[model samples]
Target: MLEDKNQEKTSLSELGEFGLIKHLTKHFSSYHKTTIKSVGDDAAVIDSSEKQTIVTTDLLIEGVHFDLSYMPLKHLGYKAVMVNLSDVYAMNAEAEQITVSIAISNRFPLEALEELYAGIQLACNTYNVDLIGGDTTSSTKGMLLSITAIGKANKEDVIYRSGAKPTDLVVVSGDLGGAYLGLQVLEREKQVFQVNPENQPDLDNYTYIIERQLKPEARKDIPELLKELDVKPTSMIDISDGLSSEIMHICTQSKTGCKLYEEKLPLDPQVISTCEEFEIDATMVALSGGEDYELLFTISIDDYDKIKGNPNLSVIGHITEENQGMNLVTRANQEIELKAQGWNSFKG
Candidate 1:
């Protein structure tokens, strides 16, 4: 008789794409009554019932997406939900529900999972979103989280990246680059801890910036504010992938160009001071640092007057014809072409 080989292990890389998908979806079955179609198709079709539905998803991986050593499971859970909701807001829609799935290893304790759920529940309550359903599984490696957020919007009110036109004013909400600088502070402190276990982190001066990194809030109010002002964004995207990269995305999709002014870029005082302390260039940080979670949008020139004086909004540039290309003008009056050094997970 042949020996039993049921205990043999297989590598994920050996299975490749199709085999991996099969392995993952093997035990998953459609449980929702509204699910018209589930996996095995190019796209999953759902019953819309004449209502426009918005879909967004986010992926969080260990080490790359977060550092478990300093990041509490609760904050990690809250941030996972907030990041996807930010995308819904970018679409000018109201987020109503989310489905969360997690893959974890045996190293995590049951209490840790509970702490993570607590944070997720807090965010759901705060945003008034329903945690519809999800899947839990064992991972061969580290923790991985994926969230899919579903939102609703009227067909007429939906905003897309293709609506921007030349001469429209470019605007941004809140400040920029604080989160990236905060990460720098945290990493520096972590290094110190590794070198000397007895040394306590000097975090008093970096409280504001550090919070910006660990706990970023989505700009859910921007959509309501635009409605109150009787203005709709011609084009918009959240600033998760650095200011310059997001601006390029809007310009590319809208078939337009832009001229952003350095003097007009908003920076919090704490961000500037932190950059100075770390001996890093503030301008570079403002332009290329990611995870700000602010809104970058464009509006018709006529509507500029309504938003110009708004404390939460700042006009940083203006849209131009495609031939003009995207450029940034420095405070010294020199113009330079903008290039995006946004996060590339594969590269690093």
Candidate 2:
């Protein structure tokens, strides 16, 4: 009793990569004169002129990126925008606009969509960013969100990943691994709740770590502080994939190595307690736990005075020549090769 007996459906795989690109391009027409080229190059080239531009994009999928069981729609929306804005800050730029697109299944009610948008609006208000154009569509499965953020900076202010030099001091904003420990607490509580329905999970003790995981904030103030201190980082990267991975990225890109002092790795008291409770190595967590969203950068030794005694910052390591390789000097005075075991989605 179907209404459209002659209708045929096509699978995304059937169209292949090139075909899908063509199909999507057909629906869009260029409107900006600054778009020098689009859709068919190794990268999109724009006529930025005298102004410096920053570009960042993020993709959030159901199950992998979030869980409806604990993640609220509004928080998810806010987080989506915040994650992109963090990238803008990492580039030392001011985020001004964002384009959000979502693919949702029919299971989501209109009220749910409204709740999500409310979060997005909150982020826009907080960051002073405009809600630019985007698209909505029906998904074959669950919900998916993709956002592209654009920001601006002065020509001289833009930061890149390859500026680190030997002997520069490595610094990080905020503590690390709290977010990972927080997630662990949430998962443990979820398991406990599953074991007994009548028992309400007691998360009163793990509030700090849990909040660090669920509502992580980008280091928005670091850029402003840098300007005030007149210190430009020799190289910088955000701790999205853990400090070890990010440090490796900076070192590899700059053709340098580093020696991180284990005692210098910052850890919130809550993170220390939680890691102990879980019987996980706190140092390993600080090294490899992701989602801290802190800034990891290297500055010339001369700039050390600018950040010294700053409660929000810590000097963790020092860069070395590439031939020295990356190592961590433990509190026990043992040198161990640093390993980047940052979250790998494909490996589960």
Candidate 3:
């Protein structure tokens, strides 16, 4: 019946606000014990027990954060959830629930919303989280999504950006720069399509990078892996605003200095090749290209033995005394001050 409704074209006024909310969120089921009550109430209820609750929110505007021309509604929904979940993971916590509110224009049909919600449901199912509650209202412009993700962790286990001390080893999970290059590819293809509508882009060579941009997955396993290894990170943050900016955040908050090794920065082959093809520096891309969603953390140097040679982890640098300042050691051993060049929504 729901699938049939998704196939039919219906107006927002036909269902009204409450009717649309019920229709969209009817399929969500709770999996977390912390979710005491989900939806259908004046307010969603949660039982944090003795754990410390961590809440993070992010806003995604249609034209600013994403370009709808190339971004599918389903992917957009999935990415929105992933972006918020990544913040929770960065704090070394388990995300239990999320509230997804959207203001969409009437230009979007019911079927379009169903497609977006389908992606949201897929993300919730994959992450074992509950869609507790949200709001749906009319928009005069395009669309906007505001997601608030709630998570929990014991007080001792909750990591923060201010926890790092000098001599800690810096580490990152997976790779970097792929997402930014992916956007470049998509934009290039979009422009080409505009000039020649009949042309078909051969995207086989750009598969990995494109997926990185369109369907990035949060690093949900890094915290679990650290627990298994019995290694606690001194400071941690997700790579949303590029490596340089994230590194600066940790340094500034922790009141420490850092020396990032350019040679140690990890890069996928696709990212490297794409950088060469685009005539851009791969190091610069890794430093300032955001949205990798990988975890950037600092660990006690003594724990190095446990993570050494781990395929999923990379030891890229080390923390230093405050006076040392933030510097990047180039492959040729040139020391250059690291700059914060990550994404700035205000500038746009």
Candidate 4:
């Protein structure tokens, strides 16, 4: 939107790196008592007294992880934070701080960065995490963001991917496949725009899916909700990679196998209908679509009654002995070998 409007563009050189950092992070304030120091420091300090600290980092690059033609800079900033925070929440920890580093080319002006930082600040305020410290540098090509999120949890409360037991039930929060399908819609629209710039694509049917892609929220409430329900997950992971890939991560690390049922996958109504429109199998989308950001976890079957009626969670399947191997139970009652066909950066 900023690019479309003819407005004054301030050069980044006027602010310098330190000046720009100070300006961008001026609105950020610390919420957690653990944050000893926030922005404008040599290094941000946190006092995680008695609690275990969780740290997670993710890198997103232009023309690779995203396309600026379709992706807004503000949404990109918000999403960069959410992606890392999602990893922290996967460990059942509450994210308290994040240090965001970015490298941008000269094409982005001061106002452009201000818009990006506005989104970042909004995420911090919304999620109640502190913007601690980071570095800024000039890039030769395009924008690159690397965010490191810090979280805290009691030693006994932290969940690990290797903690799943054979009899534990596999559960997932919210729905799957919406974000991936959203990307498909956006990509299609981009192609259409290239062919006809004046063509206005009808996107009313894709509102939910598009929102899911642009502004995915990390499941910060899932851990708190589970604690409120007195249900601790045996093992947990956020659905960033596809369902099958993440499931395999848990199973391999835990030395266990799984039986994921195709029918049990939680799908939004839009996701189902969109899959039909795209002529893609909904089951395949649920299995291999990435960036859902929902938490997938395992719980002891003994606690089944507690969460049986929860609408936010879907009990997909159960863990099995390692020798049984990971398999997907089709709705037709046939077993298919589960494969990790999710996103792979190096696959040419």
How do the predictions measure up, each by TM-score?
A: 0.87, 0.87, 0.86, 0.86
Clash-forming residue pairs, model 2: none
lDDT, candidate 2, equals 0.84
lDDT digits (tens) for residues 279-310 of candidate 3:
99999999999999999999999999999999
Off by over 4 Å in 4: 1-49
lDDT of 2 by residue, 1-348 (tens): 745565486555556444577787988888998764455321233458877667777889998878877788988898888888887788777888999999999999999999899999998998899999899999998999999888887767767667899999999999999888988888877788789878888888888888877777777899889889899998777887788988988888799999999999999988888888889999999999988989888999999999899998899999999999999999999999988788755444
Best candidate, lDDT-wise?
A: 3
Compared with the true structure, model 1 gives a TM-score of 0.87
Residue range 119-161, candidate 1, lDDT tens digits? 8999899999999999999999889899998887776776776
State the number of backbone clashes in model 2: 0
Q: Report residue 12 deviation for candidate 3 (angstroms).
A: 35
- Lowest lDDT sum, 10 consecutive residues, model 4, at 36-45
**Model 3 lDDT, full chain set:** 0.90
Candidate 3 residue runs with Cα over 4 Å from true position: 1-49
Q: Ten consecutive residues with minimal summed lDDT in candidate 3? A: 36-45
Compared with the true structure, model 3 gives a TM-score of 0.86
Model 1, residue pairs in steric clash: none
lDDT of 4 by residue, 98-129 (tens): 99999999999998888789889989999999
Comparison by lDDT, 3 against 4, better one = 3
Clash pairs, model 3 backbone:
none
